[model samples]
Target: MLEISISSSLKDAVNDFKIGVIHYQNIVVDTLPPLIGDRLPLYYETIQLSLQEHPVSEVPGVAEWRSIFKKVGTDPSRYRPSQEALLRKIKKDGVPHFVHSAVDLINFFSVQHGIPMGIYDLDHLSEPIQITIGSDQDSYPGLNGRVMHLSGKIVSVDRTGAFGSPIVDSKRTCVTEQTTNALQIVYIRPSMELEEAKQLIQKMAEMFTQVHGGNHEWKLMN
Candidate 1:
């Protein structure tokens, strides 16, 4: 089973922070089905309308995340959280281009719930994972080809090193077509209760299995 723990270093910064993890096995990671792909345009439109009336800055979850980022020393405006970035992109582009089944699913939920999410291929990770605040010396190659300097950021570290975060995930553990087993992490905001977060993770995992053909389980960690 996949296991994760919050570091004492991170607890000092934000003790109430919680992470929801879903582990999936025997999954097919490919293009999303037309049924799901067809709905994204509608989801994007809803987000676009929502953003026009309520700016991303004023979003409850987004606002809380910005505050958390400041507490950790990173400029939220400079390195916006992943969910905020996605909302901005959808507002500007009118719709999001698909990545793959797993990624596309997570992106959809992130936008729907205003939560930051990260997914990694299980085969690439080391056991006994930890969530901690990044130091100045920690950096990883990002999915976008930029090297992410993780100082003061919330990051996931395995035995290997820092591989994932709320802002952006490292290329090292990114899920792709070859990924048969995967780990999805949801960064729950303070506005959500632990029970709500647990339900959300359960729903997400069920959806993944429903759409991607997988066996899955989820856990809540603090």
Candidate 2:
């Protein structure tokens, strides 16, 4: 089993830096078919409905991520949560779509719930996912193949070095076609509750196993 732990520095900073980790086995994380297409109608409709509810800025989860970014000494405006960024684009443009199955599921959940989610290929990660504050000089290749700096940010690193944070996920461990085992993480701020994360994971896990043929287990690890 892989271990995931939080740092004292981060806990001292936010006092509520809680994270949920999930291990998925027998997953098919490839350039998936349009398996998630059936979800598009509902997904787009929900985003449209949400536009009537409130702006992304008024979202509690987005607000929490913004605060977390600030607490970690990063500029919240520059490194916005992936979900928040997607929401803004969708609100201005329209619902976006991805072809990868894992990406499809994760992004769908993010937009549906307005939370940030990251899924890494388990084979690419080192044991003991450590959550710690990043330094000014820390950098890694992003999923898009560009180098991303992790200066003054809260990040999670394995044996391969920093891979993910509230702002962005690294390219080294991004899920791919051959990623059968997945380490999925749903980022929740203190403003968010452990139970909330648990419920979301439970729902996603069910879909993953029943709809996508993956066996999974999950936990709420600080």
Candidate 3:
């Protein structure tokens, strides 16, 4: 019952801007777990360390965060946990593992791409997943009882609630072995160029194939 639609304007803009889209089908199993202990890849670790050291107040997006909160009616300053903190916990504690092929695939893709991606248990979601800005009350308790603030940024939501955060996800909507079909989404923000995004997507698809033991069959969006 899950329905997904990309707005005509958004699609047109993406086409005009030459944005890149990469889609993966079946995902691998073992890749979801951390390679060794709680250590993440260098890219993920570096970003986490930088954010922890700088704090949001000193970042270039501090002002933008304020504006986004105002627009979405949520206070970004009030929701100030470091992403590294959350990631480290997930790495150490282990996420609830899912068995769906598509869900696993996108998870790997997101990790490899160093961006946020999501997969919804299509059977569980309502039709037409809507993309919109979050409201003040749009917080969700994720893994480890952490509340995620979704106000003021784009999110893919169904009747069950948010499937993915801008750069993270809530365990509430995560896919599992019971999932039959899935709706996968990868966010290619405005800042990323088409070619670079495409290359990253390609690499991700290739990696999925190599690790999961599958053939490549990707469809482009823009």
Name the candidate that leads on lDDT: 1
Cα miss at 178, model 1 (Å)? 0.9
Tens digits of lDDT, candidate 2, 121-197: 88898887888898776689876567878878878888768998766789888888888898878776566667876
The per-model lDDT (C-alpha) reads: 0.88, 0.78, 0.49
Model 2 alpha-carbon miss at residue 122, Å: 0.8
Q: Could you arrange the candidates by TM-score from highest to lowest?
A: 1, 2, 3
lDDT measured at residue 117 in model 2 versus the true structure, 0 to 100: 81
lDDT per residue, candidate 3, 1-222, as tens digits?
224555453344234322223333454334344442234344445655555565534444333333333443445455432232234333444432334445555644444343445555455667656665666766676643577777655456777776655445667666665443445555553446677767766776575555445354443344
- In model 3, residue pairs whose N, Cα or C atoms come closer than 3 Å (at least 3 residues apart or on different chains), thus clashing, are 3-128, 27-105
Q: All candidates: CA RMSD in angstroms?
A: 1.1, 2.2, 6.4
Off by over 4 Å in 2: 30-36
As a TM-score, model 1 comes out at 0.96
Best-to-worst lDDT order:
1, 2, 3
User: Number of the top candidate by TM-score?
Assistant: 1
